[model samples]
Target: MNRDPSGGACAAEQLVEAGVRPTRPRLAIMEAIRTGATRHLTPEAFHRELADGGVHLSLATVYNTLNHFSEVGLLRRVGFGDRSYYCTNAAEHHHFYDEATGRLEDIPGAQPQVVCLPEAPPGMEIDGVEVIVKLRRSRQYPR
Candidate 1:
């Protein structure tokens, strides 16, 4: 019922089909994480935006829902350390997380360079895999 007319209607539909109740708070959360300029975001940052925008959602709820979304494959978790980020992988592709700026950018599956593995490590032939290119500004400048 509560949806931005000009916002991500596709995300909304996906959420519904994914069995997630599209509540107002969930809609707001989805809209930000789904259609925002920023891709990689922590739960604190995400909830901060929701609060800053005057959308009444608690950080706890955001964390809970994000966890659920990840489990349901609606989103993907990036990074390994304490610094955590989430990205909506509605499209099947990889991602590039810029560490210097702490941002996540989607890298489409259709890339100029293709990597193929001839043999499997063990008995597993092949499964879906992704590559995250974490970027940072060059620190050195040659004279």
Candidate 2:
């Protein structure tokens, strides 16, 4: 795995800093994600990565760990339909979801503009906004 950009904090150190126990599986999982090709990953993909890394962990364990990490603010969970993807980037940002390839990418630079919004109900407040701009290949191209 490549060294963490911020002075090289290992998986164990990252877990501990996030107030999570530095267990073997947790460390391995963190390493798998931090070293992955992409930031957005579903449980199934993560499971395959773990398997390929020679780390034997059940699918249930992978799910549970992901859930735990999300709950502890170590990861962000993005849901679409019946599937959930875990994102390693916890910073506030939007996503571009490709319908054709079922891929999700971070929308960098600036936050999207919220032009208008209706009033909230009694005693309610706006928590936050999650914008997912879905995309698909154009069909008008000459074949």
Candidate 3:
């Protein structure tokens, strides 16, 4: 929509199926996330990607689009302390966040098993599970 129009129409179709209007900016955002060097991105990274591709969007728009996509199950939100990242793989799985490189990778095959969970509040229900395993290289001192 902002630059390339070829993928915009297809993106619109996909967005429409997801019950989203598929506006120009939304289409651009989708294209940015779906086709990129990395599948997982924080809002800041997403904005940078858009910029690199000659597509301009405000930070608020990026946040809004990420929120909307997550609400519709198109993206998975992974959090670390105070930071968050959005992933395109919404399948049931966990993540491995590399602190050294600030990269997120999918850990598929098996989801985390919770032995016991506290009872939900009255009239409340339990949602899905999200586990993020942060990793960093172990430092070795001089022998």
Given candidate 3, what's the lDDT at residue 64? 91
Model 2 lDDT per residue over 119-138, tens place: 78999988657789998877
User: TM-score for all predictions?
Assistant: 0.66, 0.84, 0.82
Return the top candidate by lDDT: 2
lDDT for model 3, please.
0.78
Cα lDDT listed for each candidate: 0.70, 0.81, 0.78
Q: Which ranges in model 1 have alpha carbons more than 4 Å from their true place?
A: 1-13, 34-38, 108-128, 139-143
> Model 1: per-residue lDDT, tens digit, 34-143?
55643556899888888888877878999988887777767776656577677655445677776767777777557435477567788677655657777777769423
Candidate 3 wrong stretches, greater than 4 Å: 1-9, 139-143
Give RMSD (Å) of candidate 2 vs. truth: 2.7
Better of 2 and 3 by lDDT: 2
Off by over 4 Å in 2: 1-7, 115-126
The lDDT of model 2 is 0.81
Query: In model 2, what are the clashing residue pairs, if there are any?
Result: none
